[model samples]
Target: MNSTRMRITTIAKKELVEFVRDWRTIVAILVIPVLMFPLLFILFPLLLEAEAQELDELIVDVELQADDLPDGFQSALEYSSINLTFAELDAVENLTEPGTAMEKLRSGEVDAVVRVRANNSTWQYAVLHMSTSEQSNEARSRVLLNLGEWEQNETRNRLVAVDLDPDATLNPLQWNGSIAQGDVASKGEQAGLALSLFIPLVLAVWTFSSAIQPSIDMTAGERERGTLEALLGLPCTRAELLFGKWLAVATITAAGVLLQIAGLTFAIGYLATSDIISAPTMTLGVVALLCVAVLLFAITVVAFELALAMRAHSVKEAGSVLGPAVLLILFPALFTQVINLDGIELFWFAIPVVNVLLALRELLLNRVVPVHVLVWMVSSAVYATLAALYAARQFNREDIVTTLS
Candidate 1:
């Protein structure tokens, strides 16, 4: 037991030295996420806000047949922040007949053109035209509200025309229900799920990248440098060496994942406070779930990477073999978006990366996950352990090691 501990400690120290001495590896593990968070969370929102602030003043052309329409109809447009310009019949004829107004609106000289026909009664129809779909949609919304007022006025006119009293209809059935207020924690949880959808994907990328370099260096790089042969010739048993190296890789990978979590948490919190994003505060429970998820992901990545590294002739070859694994992590994230959690099957919980993501998302959203989630998490951990053992067996094979050399 003492011998194993000493071997692991030595390997861990050696790995740490290699990691710290390499500036590129150190920066990848630390600096990239720290920089990415603020840019993604803070700068992006500010840019969007700036763009939204520049509102184009809409030019509206309204023609009413009646000398006076109800003030409510005009007020509706005013309330919607529309700038209305009333046009005389002569102006409408010149604009529409010559198609000058339509051309102006299309040329960006005018925001929108609203045409009211000469036969405008309370049952009048208005036509709006805009160059862009977005502007047209907004103009349509404002015009619809004005049209509603026109309908109301038409109804009132018909009531007066028919000599029917407006107050004759009595309401017998009433709806009197109060809305239940939710606490901040509940609201925060709702917001957290929306924010946390990408966390699993981010975690997976961090795990893959963090594990890749170390796994390649420990296996293919060691063999290329003739260190593996020297180490194999030592008094230490192959099992002890494999265990030590695996432990070392797992620790490094886990540390990198932890750094990513910390950076992401801080970035998200900062951005939320700044109103850059609408993420919830990171609670202890949320952090715990994230930590566990990351731990499991790290174990899986380390085992997978080590196995690939053992098969490759060089670090470059190992990278080529492992690149596809990083892309595979995106599948869980994409699946989370496409697959509704409410429709999740119990069997899905047995899948490794997918389960962790689903469980963490549920935790973030304050949803009560089933006990099977925990059961699956335990199963994933066990599976990772078995994978590590399999990789170790591969490491002990004489033919494989010799082939790599």
Candidate 2:
């Protein structure tokens, strides 16, 4: 037992020294993700807000018969600061036809067109059009306000004509909607899902990239350089070597995951506090779940990467083999987002990366995951352990190592 511990400690120290000495590798592991999340989550929303403010200005084209417009209608349009441009009713004879008006609106020549019917009644119709898809919302708001004023005037005229009281009760109805299932997830849940969907992908990338290069270089790269044989002849047992290498990979991957989490937490907190997003506060419980999930995810990825690395002749070859595994880790997490399985099912918990993402999402939303979530976590850990053991067995084989060298 002491010998095994000493061997593992020796290998772990060597791995740490190699990792720290490579400045480029260290930067790749730490800097990129730390910078990306803040830029994506924080600055992107600010840009959108600026664009929305710019979109609020709209121009309206009015073509009303001189007598058809009510007394206060034009004044109302002016009061709303709708940039009203007028064209003679005949000047737009066929040019201002419905289709032409629509084309003009789509082309940005006008924000909206108001056409007063030849009948001098107060029942004239207005159609507002916007060039840009985003500008349509602002156009709709202005159109609705103008339409409401017109409706009110028409209602008063009818009341006066019928000699009826304005306050007489019309169709009286009351309606309400309620859900009795467990406390319905608020908009906060949706926001949480949105914030967390990329977390799994981020973790996968960090784990694979941070561990893959070093893991391959530690094993396959040493083999290519003829240094692995010397180390193998040392009195180190296979389990000790594997444990030490695994520990090193886990350390780097875990550090990467921690850095990613730090970046993500800062970005998310900024967004929530700034009112850009309506996510709930991440409690200690949720943070604990996230930490566990990230740890397991890192171990699984590092194990898989080392297994592939052990099979390759060189670091480049190992990278090629492990590239797909990196993409595969993203799948289970991505699948969680695309699949909306019922929360009560135990089957989903048995799945690997998917289970972790689902559990974390539930935690963030303050949902109590079933006890089976722990069972699934244990199962995933078993799977990762078995993979590491299998890789260690491969490392113990003389023929496989010789062929790679």
Residues 78-184, candidate 1, lDDT per residue (tens digit)?
64356666654334443334244556556655455555443444323445466365565556665676777766666766777889754453224544564435344
lDDT of each: 0.67, 0.70
- Model 1 ranges off by over 4 Å: 55-185, 224-227, 271-290, 337-344, 365-370, 399-405
- Report lDDT (Cα) of residue 289, candidate 1: 68
Encode model 2's per-residue lDDT on 244-360: one tens digit a residue.
Answer: 888888887787777777788788778878766776556677667667766776677777777788888877788788777766666676777666645457777777767766766
As for model 2, its CA RMSD to the true structure in angstroms is: 5.2
**Best-fitting candidate, scored by TM-score:** 2
How does candidate 2 fare on TM-score? 0.73
**Residue pairs in candidate 2 whose N, alpha carbon or C atoms collide under 3 angstroms:** none
